[model samples]
Target chain A: MSALVTGATGFLGRRLVRLLREDGLQVTCLVRPSSDIEPLRQAVGDALWSGVDVRTVELMDENGCREALLGCSVVYHLAAGLSGSTSTLFLNSVIPTRRLMAASVSAGVQRFVLVSSLGVYGTQTLPPGTVLDERSPVDPHPHLRDPYTFSKVVQERVAWDAYKASGLPLVVVRPGVIIGPGRGVLSSRVGLRLGPLMVRMGGGQQLPYTYVDNCAAAVRQAGLAERAEGQVFNVVDDDLPTAKELLRLCRKAGAGVKSAWVPRPLVQPLAGAYEWYHHWSRGQLPGVITRYRTAAMWKPLQYVNDKAKAGLPWRPEVPFDEAFRRSLTIAPAIG
Target chain B: MTTSPSDMIRVALVGCGQIADAHLQEIRKIPSAETVAVCDVHQDFADQAAARFEVPRAFDDMQRMLSEASPDVVHLTTPAHTHCRLATELLQAGVHVYVEKPFTVDVREAEAVLEAAHAEDRSVCLGHDQLFDPSWVQCRAMVQAGAVGDVTHVESVLGYPFSGQFGRQVATDRNHWVRKLPGGLFQNTISHPLYRITEFLTDDRPALHANWFAGSADVSIPTELVAHFRGEQVTGNLLFSTRIEPQRITRVYGTHGALEVDLDAQLVRRSRQNRLPGAFEKLEMPLRHCREATGNLCRNVWRFLKSDIHYFAGMRCLFEEFYASVRSGSPPPIPYEGMLRVTRLMEAMFEQCREREEAGDTAPRHSQERIKVESDHTIKSDQRSNQRPVTTNRDESRELQEAWS
Candidate 1:
């Protein structure tokens, strides 16, 4: 099989590209013109570089993307704008993805796997302790969330819209925070780093973490699996640690952290108060904490990857402790 | 001097860019303003915009649009470099002009445009719509009402995202129009923070010192600016940063209190002196914050229900005021003096930046110096030859379990 991967230079993208190559597939890496591919070359090493084809094409350039996708049967699109203003995020991420979807349909690709984020779920509105699975609805009002999450929600919407309209083979893999070497272990899921102080929202909430290699494998499986078409999979590793346990592990690993814990019950009210203050003060302090965002981040919920495990027939190869150890061996932060 | 309510103001738009859509959308909301024509150098864009907005006419040539459409008012949403000539031509053709921000390339061009408007007896408005945001309007009203006492200082900080479409275009494309401007990337946006400062500073020529440098390694053109202006009694600072979290806020400090306006969020907040004594003040502050926040939440909910909340609410308000001015033959929404002052300030800052660029002194110095200082300090402080290595790499999972035990 020949596969094309966008964002093949990113942390997770590099891993996915390598894994796809290892599975005896001819891999074509679609990178932006300005993207630095040296890191990708280093990650793939000198030996495996023979089978990998690198194509410099902007996703917004429909003709270029169509040309790049000419021989590729499967496409793994992982490129997205992580942060920006709403319009910026929409233009950079959503609009390009829409164009790519159009180009993919035109190219007659077999399968198009979209790597989305678990943050797209409308979990805050759900009752606490609800099992957040593939069936969970995405954010209804994405504009109320941060620009990054808002863009992702819209990107998924457009992907589904394409799927419904053109019968494009689509599979969405919503991965949790991917942690590995070079990338830090900390994420907003654990706590927000507000300057020197970390505001750890709640302790009992499970940190839905998928090690980068494990996430890449699941994404590969999603593209290859026949059952994954027209399905959404939540890619999360088993034996996840709670936010407190993760913080404790970090502290034990000689990473000094100063944290203030907010109890689970008080999290929502505190966020409301914080949102109120942030808005009332005309953003005197950064509007990092808002009621909607806090609810989305800290709400106590259970994550299930049963659909992914069953449909993709995949299991996380790396144990949580082993993954944590490998992550800490190179970097202190894991996210 | 005024048109009847039944009479509509025929409006044409030039440069069918991203902002042209905003102008057209807001114009459509007002029954008094009729979008008669849309024009762009790119004829396809003009046609697309006209079709999308249901405008009657689309033309690639400005002269043809003006002559054929006969629009009473023309919105100049073209590039800043083209703004001066376009505004001048539009005014000479007996039409009022509304130019987008960074009104012109420099004060000279701004003067020429204003001169043309004066000669034609037509009103001209710059797109300084942030000042017209409901939050900012309320903040200004509070300041005028002495709620914030006498203004002493103003700090305007704008956080731009280099990953944004405009930023990417400017950074990647060397020949992009924004790169050709006097201030390069900063010229396109520095006007926002500058005008916010001038609203309170009210000084045409303030003692100014500006530092411009690229905070990120992506582009060479300056993306970060820290400008200080001392306006006789009040001191103002403008921070335009592309590397930070995106925000648009202006803070005004006064004798008794301070007020901040978050134009993006459309919220206004103030800080007053705490009268409580001792550690109780610390507890009092959060409670007060909650109270103020709750109040804003209630008000915002009301506004949202009333459909008064939107990304382009400020632009809509500005359009209404500008259109009203045009109909009544009154002065434009923004005073000519204020526009001139903002343009002059921008010219001064850009001049300093250009000088620094020519001197080859625009690169950020602190990071390089800090790296050197840290390396030297590390070399000087290494005196642990006899010390044993710290055993900090124990199995954290086991340690975490034991801590619970």
Candidate 2:
């Protein structure tokens, strides 16, 4: 199968493009005009890079997107704006997806795989340990969340709208926070980074993490598998470590991370206090630890990947311990 | 509380959303104004607002509330597009109107609303509240009194935080009313800065040039804007940015000195050439700045003690002025001519930006070229001085490390 991959220069996109090229697919890498492709070329090596058709096209260019999408049966859209103002996020993330979907449908692409985030799910109000599967509803009030999550929610909505409107075969893969080399284990799930101190919210909550390589593998399978069309897959590794255990492992590896742990029971009240102070002080303090954000990020919920295992018929190749070790080896030791 | 029921102005409010809280709270502070009825398309919002503010009645329909409560003045706090239609209707119903700004979508809508107000012989006020802040009042007084002689130039900067309630709502919703505006989110907010310029640059039609850019990867609409206005007498520059730290300030430069009014801090300062000779001038300037800072600090503390240092202090001043004008049969606090002038200038500015965007030239190509020129000059300078090569790579590496962390 031939595939067109956007965000091919990103951390996860590089591995995904490499895996697809190895599988002998004619892959066309769509990149932004201002993107630096040297790192991607180095990651894939000169031999594979030479074979890959690299196209620098703006996602907003409808005609260019259609032309680049031609002859590619499957498209993997992994590009997303991680942080920006609301307008920036929408323009960068959501508008491009809408345009790309239109182009994909016009170019007769068979399946479009959208790489979304697990953060799009509205699990704040759900009881603890609730099995958050593919059937769980997306955030209805995404505007209340961070701009990145809001954009992802809107982008996913646009993709699904395209699927329903144009009959463009679609399979979405919502991966948990992708962690590997170049990215450390410290995530929002663990705590807020208040200057140098990491205010770890709760320790017992399991971190929903997917190794970049494993995520890439599942994404590749999502494009190739016969039963994957019209399905949503949550890509998460089988074994996971709680926030406390991850911190323990990091310290054991001689990464002296600065952290203060808030017990699980005290998380809500502390967040309430922060929120109250944020409002009472007339925004002198940043509204980073609101009850809504705290509930969304630090909630103790069970994430199920049964749909991905059955639908894509894929498994995470790298074990959690092996992935953790690989990631820490390259990451700078926390000061 | 001071005014009797018969003498008080019966005020009704439309659009009981986030900004309505500020309106109601400020109106309550004015004894002459009583919020009689509140209305919203969302019944829950109207009901909640009524309960919170202790308004007499609430209505989902504005027309019903207008007829039953019979308010003397109405605050049209609805969305921008709805302003022209609603304001005209309210005027025809024999009620004065106070519109939350971006008074109407375009110059044509603004003119129509103004005409309707004239025909009905009822006063209309545009919510250019920032100009009424104590700091701005002081700055304007200084300019009029020739502290800053013959206002030659003006600069206004309005920095919006996208994380704020209104910004978040617009940013997250694709079909938001703001996105439908001619200049997108800029249309809704550019007025505040533009109005400040219009106060000095009173030319009905200014030669305008604007450059709009997305600035960041996350927004498609122009979040950063730089516009220039060359009026009949004064030159003006406006910087409306979302990426910067939130601030609202305006600086006016005249022949004698410059005045800067920091709206957020409710502080005003003046800059002029030092009178002291040579080396003593340097010391004198710092001492003067220190004295000015101390004075401003004291003033702010006093205002805070009097419970006047508020996010909506300017709005409170605006409300008091408008209500006083209404009661005394004076022209509206914000003149229709000034409102129309700003709206007209805004139209021209947004049009210039739209034309540029349509030409497919939204990228920061100018900055790129400037960087190239500067780098070439630096390389030549370094060779001439026999110094080590410039350290661009180290800065890039450090930036990358910071981003990674």
Candidate 3:
């Protein structure tokens, strides 16, 4: 069997490709024309790399993308623009997807799996103690949203739109905050670094973060399982750790440094000041206070994966504590 | 190495450490520069370097390589402390020299190297190659072209990645060579930004002020520093740290506008004064920055796609310039006076630090005692020599202006 995968250069895409290869499927990776493949080569190992084929196309090139997807059985649409303004987000994420999905359909791909984000729920803050499942209502149009969330929201709608209109077998996998290795598991810069400290906000609010490998596994499951077709899945770890607990675990597993907590009220002000300073000084004080993710930072994110658990033969492989510990160490080589 | 053309420059690299690869890789590009020999104190390192670079000769002994290879120039890639002695030896042997930065261990050693360079009547270039970095070159040109109008103040920062293998080694290993330098790791690494900043200010004896914070108990070194340099015309700030993620940035502020030069991203972001009202600036400034950042992103991505970016590109440019000066009898790429002045500035800063320690100001609080914040004036204020020669080097009438793109 042959599988076509987009975003093969991303965090989850690398692992998903590895998983697909291990399953004895020939993998074709649809990479951006200008994307560096050295990282992909490093991620997928040289010895067993013969089974994988990487094709480069400008995302806007519909025919090129369609040609790359040709003769492949399954398609995994995992590529996303991480951050951008509204127009850029629409241009990079939405338009590319609308194009790629059209190409996937034209190529008669077996299954189209869309890797979306839990942010589509905008469940960043629900009523206190409210749990969210796949069927729960989502904000039709999320407001005051970060470009990432807004883009993911719009991208998911596009995927579902294609599914309803074109009868394309699509599965939407919405993953929570992915905590992975400090280096090389996903994005080169993403991961839990051994910083001198892990500063937590919102006084130990519950956070819906998933271990990266587990999230990758869930995504892989969503792609392969027939029952996952035309359905939505919320992928997260079994237990959502509180911000304080996460920080404590990070300090223990990470640089073994001090842990500090800024109260909920103060976080907003800090973020506001940081925003003003960032604009006024042009990032002279970077990563100091961060963007006004005050709402996301302050509110508790409680995601329920019951639908995914019932539908797919997958469970959270790594628990919260183990995931936290593994994030601090070098990721084990998995075949 | 193959037989060279009459104008071909035969180069031998001494000290086959990590940096030697950069030199070897870059030397392959220049048609006239042929790397004839590789040398290191360790025989295995010499052999490995020679095989790696496909050079004709490898030797554990520098003298043996110099005599046998008879190269036009010897690149001194050894530890900073060893630079003075080795450079002097090569210069005395009537060979042109290029030493990696910290040019030498301290002021005295730099002076000795300077004297040797003059005595041999040979060119000696310090590897402050960021001088030729396209980004910095563009930045300096902008300053000259009044892009940032009358450069009033400049700040340059050097950040080390202490979380990686090399960084972890530097953090844990107290016996590392960097820890043994006069100013410890700062003396070893600060030369990068210090020289970059010195290029603009051109003051021989700039006033120095510095504050440091201990990184951690395990590191056993003060890994964070903020140093200010007040000059004749430009006020400068130097931020040095091993705490932050590895970054090199130089921001120049002027009366009309300001520009931030990012070495990592390889771009310059020029910011003009926002003419909007105070309340509206909150909205407009961010939008303006977004415009500049996005514009730079598109440009840099295009450049990258065109294969315009290369690691050690600055090193390659400097090597070319150094070889050019060697081929011609032009003044050296890095003037001897600027080299010595950088060293003197470093020495002066360390001198004040020592004076503070002797003054019984131990356990200085971060809030209270910013010990070496010198406000009055320069060291050797009245009797400053080496000023004119370096100032002339910084003038617009240099040969380096033409080499820049």
Q: Highest lDDT: give the candidate number.
A: 2
Model 2 lDDT per residue over B377-404, tens place = 6557866896644445765434433433
Best by DockQ: 1
- Residue A93 miss distance in model 2 (angstroms): 3.4
lDDT of each: 0.84, 0.85, 0.75
RMSD values for the candidates in order, in angstroms, are 13.7, 10.9, 22.8
Could you arrange the candidates by lDDT from highest to lowest?
2, 1, 3
Model 3 lDDT per residue over A219-308, tens place? 877778876678989887887767666545544554444545677667667778877865454333332344334554355545677877
Residue B289 error, candidate 3, Å: 2.8
Better of 1 and 3 by TM-score: 1
* B295 Cα displacement, candidate 1 (Å): 28
Better of 1 and 2 by lDDT: 2
Residue range with the least summed lDDT across 10 consecutive positions in model 3 chain A: A184-193
